[model samples]
Target: MKVLYNHEYPRRVRLAAIGCGGHAIRNVFSTHPYAPIDLVAVCDLDRERAEHTGCMFGAKAAYTDYHEMLEREKPEAVTVVTNYDEDGRPRYPQIAIDCMQAGAHVWIEKPPAASSAEVLDMMRVSEATGKFVAVGFKKMFFPANVKAREIITRPAFGSISTITARYPEALPPLEDRQDLHKMWRFLDHIVHPWSVLQYLAGPAESIFVQRSPTGGTVTAIQFASGAVGSLHLDRGQGSSSFLERTEIVGPGGNVVIHNNTKLTFYSDGPKPAGGYGRSGDYYGGDERAALHWEPEFSLGQLYNKGIFLLGYAPEIRYFCQCVLDDTPPEVGTLDNALEMLRIYEAYCQPDGQHIRIDTEPGKVS
Candidate 1:
């Protein structure tokens, strides 16, 4: 298979899109024109919204019910970007299962399911139907995060000793977790950081957490790789402030991502010439010095678009390409979804108590 690049002859993948909501309108649907997909149909519970999105994206048909759309269109694949219910439950697993059973591949949005049980069901359906299902874990699709994954996996970086992820979200207190309404906000948002952790480090072995009175939650995680990690939910940060910051520490180097866009790598360094009080300069011509990357917004290029810069376009293209080649997706597989759900469930229990996640190889906790 050809490696996908920014500009290339597009390989066509027939597709049906589901959900005509704000997220699909702004991110998923907008990215199809740039990917290797032909939007053949659109489906939504609201007929008017479905027709509007279908017409806007040049789809041939629109339907209020996804089952009708799948039966009529018989698309090679389907994209799902629906919103969560008031109870924080995801509605995509059943739809995805139906699409897969209808002989179409599926690309469902993040928070693949409300719980790990749902993900297991989707996996069983996919296996039985011989169709692949790729969850839209968009954070792992970002260029910076991709590069960070590559960096952390290198031999020179050694085994990752620690990781810290910061995102502006809040988890309800333990007492409120049983209420689906109270947990809904967290269920919708925690997938972002959870995906990153699973991508770079691997499955979390165990987790201990603390919930703040102000709605924020803090977690300490131990990965199967024996690396420690911290997840800080910042409920009170100003929206104007950088939304995220992540750091991964290895033997003699570390990588830091600022605001989800800028990435800097700090490698082994030489000692300063003078004493601690009289250091000469931050940079001293060391060969193994730091490296950094951030996009320049001046150019009116494809990179300037949020869909491209933030990984939405790349992720869509990846799914389409996998479908065209009859291959499974690497980033958003059922196994990854299972790991993410494990972390989500860890927060449901009270703080300072460890939760064990069952895995194929062994027990995680």
Candidate 2:
């Protein structure tokens, strides 16, 4: 795939943005040159932020109200990045609905909603409007994870049998789980590993979560594909440490991704140099050696940019491709958000017992 500059595309979708906050500025807007967008305008509740972002991005139109921006700009696509309300309800859901209703497709930031019902509501509206919506499930877009995805699905890897993910997350105390504001931290970040699991193993059908007194959790999940997986929530890990690890095991081999950048795939290759027990050397032939990949930062390259390495650019580029080609996005859809939120809701329930995740429509179970 070719990475195009803003001017390289023959025609570009007219794009406007809601919320010019730090994330929108640093990650979303920075991807403009890599995605095919005309950048019609910018909107934020604060006048100075709206104007400043518009000026910074060469968008001449600026509005404090998204409604005004949507109506006046007539953009074909809109990207939203907003924080939570006083009640801990994310602002992205309602804004995304508004964007879809205004005849534009949407690309919204994560923590898509506070509940599964909210995600369902977005789903219903998206179907009604014939507008596609993409959520920011960034981990699924990470270069290393993307490569792992490709490697595992190839015929060489055989069929996936298990998955293991480690991420630093803590479940709220049982008493605090009932409060949306208190549980906000869990909702905001759990998707990092959960989305990766879904992206690799498909939807989980059942889960049994066990929590520690120290606030950590270990969840055993049964995927609909019949692949079992475990998610390790390392609650007390230091802030400076590398954040994540994902490993997928198949009958033929296992692939591992470290901190979302380095990837190593161990296929069922031949034994060591002379044989398993007879070899003096541990190394094997190059044809059957573990395949490894990681980005090099010494040179200037699109893949080396934080925007690309962290998935911000790729996700935006994907959304833009879906809009440009008029194809529905298979990744980061509201259906995926609903599944992720179902798992979040399961965490709210009393742990120890297995919780079955339902796939039906309507209110959250």
Candidate 3:
């Protein structure tokens, strides 16, 4: 619930941003004022876009070349949001590696790479430069998802047994899977469900995907901890419908998030006064009732802002906090990116088979 304005923060990291695309402008740069950083410059390949975005925000300068921006501005950290390479691989890994080599930490947007091998290269660069790279796995920062993670970690929650997620996405056909460009869409969007899933249920070891004729898919996952899960990528779901739902179950209860905002935690309640069908009262004690939360937009609260509600500000803050503290980020680290990319690689394989994901923790198979 902490809200710190960029200008008011007595000491802030020197931040520069690359990529002036719609998403970077809307979600990332829009959050600059709320994060703990002084945006020194904006960079993009398009000079007009760079200048426009820099002027829109309060950046002191703008440049068309990021390498030039890095050398001239010497920002302590940089946020990168870029398009994928022609091969369908994200441009982030190489960009982030370069940022680290420039002696600055990096915050890059998701789908960190097309494969685990690329993430591993980023990891190597990060270690060599001693600068951490934080991927924008925003769902991990979503307030509801954060709350769900908290609820699941409580001792009262018992062991996490399962996770179920639904997202409106479609997988490429088996034939198309061999081509990175053909997998462009799946690589871009699958990270949403997988980010929330991995954020809740750590370290999955395998996945079994079954694709519907219409391109929807039901992916079953087995975690290293012995928990099982499923993701329903509803390809043909209504566009107007809410995009996502995620739930994690524990022996004591479960927590669910709907549409990235509303959350309900159903905890184990007191035993009924009577047994089974004989129980007359459906009500439970005050403390045992289900806990629920969702932001109210009426007052213009920070939580009501799309940036905060959808996790952009929090993600930026988390990365900035790490930079300010001179420590590696705990969330959205290269390890997390690597883990998710491994699962992404699993998706690139033929569907309808139980593909084993490499689980050696950041080691590319």
Candidate 4:
């Protein structure tokens, strides 16, 4: 298929995919037609599923074993989106290392590893083989989240004073946390909120949390940037409830992302005098003052698709672009994975204790 580009379509990257499961089938495979990737093969533990996906996506072959797929296909890149093991462990680290060793860049799903040690091992292999591993920390790629990053970095936003992130998830109690099986659900999902906080606020200096009897928890985090933040895990919330709402407050202005898609920027407006009440005017400034973006379901637009708007497609495009350009991914890099692991480890211990993270240099320490 011919790949389209804004200016000129560059050479598409040959790709092999691992794990033909629900996420891969729904999001990743659906994105191939839009990205600069040529899907050459699909592999899964289930031979039937792999072959089905391969036939559906026009892959040349399918295999039950990823190693055989990698050895035979020798594609430039691979996408790993398998499920966790019975022990609540991620199974992609070894597969990713194998792919990197075979001279292919890898893009794996979240919770890059079951532990920090696994990620370090993959990092070592990636460095030794001169290949890259991009974890799908898709929150960093969300259009609203990306815009929030830009807003916080602007001089006018000043030094980010605080951030508040709300996601519908709960952490296991401290006693149960020791068991990877008990904590598996938390470990798998905590990366979502952690990625958002780390991307916008920098590394967390310390964390203090309180868990509820029913399994909900609230964590207060202090960033190395000297910015404070809060994470609220709503355990009892309905699954149909809005999953995310984030806000970043700087010296003057602030940005709020409603439901993970609508972004609103409240720029610095003139303060009222002592005698004056709230003004009637709702509009803040000219074209530059207020900005917002949300999909109009009424129209047939690419933005309406979950693949494009929900961060999966854009993230795949990002990895493909990095490979074609021979550049390291800014997001989903090993360093980001390390930071996320640190947060996961911190939560494993008891709450109300401070755990300091060693952040990278020049990062507002």
Candidate 1 segments whose C-alpha is farther than 4 A from its true place: 1-10, 86-88, 274-281, 286-288, 361-365
Runs in model 2 lying further than 4 Å from the true structure: 273-276, 360-365
- Best-first order by TM-score: 3, 2, 1, 4
Q: Could you tell me the lDDT of residue 348 within candidate 1?
A: 86
Query: How do the predictions measure up, each by TM-score?
Result: 0.93, 0.96, 0.97, 0.93
lDDT of 3 at 360: 76
| 141-184 per-residue lDDT for model 4 (tens digits) | 88889988998899878999999999988877778987888887
Q: What does candidate 2's lDDT look like per residue over 1-365, in tens digits?
A: 56889889898889999989999999999999888888899999999989999999888699998998998888999999999998889988889889999999999999899888788888888888899889999987988888888999999787789999999989988899989989998999998899999899888999999999999999999988889999999988988999999899998899999988899998898877776578997767777788889989999999999999999999998999899999889898888899889889999999899999985544422
Q: What's the true lDDT of residue 343 in model 1? A: 74
Q: Which RMSD values do the candidates have, in order?
A: 2.9, 1.9, 1.5, 3.4
What alpha-carbon RMSD in Å does predicted model 2 have with respect to the real structure?
Answer: 1.9
Report the error of model 2 at residue 163, Å.
0.7
| Clash counts for all predictions | 0, 0, 0, 0
In model 4, what lDDT does residue 172 have? 77
Best by lDDT: 2
lDDT for predicted candidate 2 compared with the true structure: 0.90
TM match of model 1 to true structure? 0.93
Model 4 stretches astray by more than 4 angstroms = 1-8, 272-289, 360-365
Better of 2 and 4 by lDDT: 2
Clashing pairs for predicted structure model 1, backbone only: none
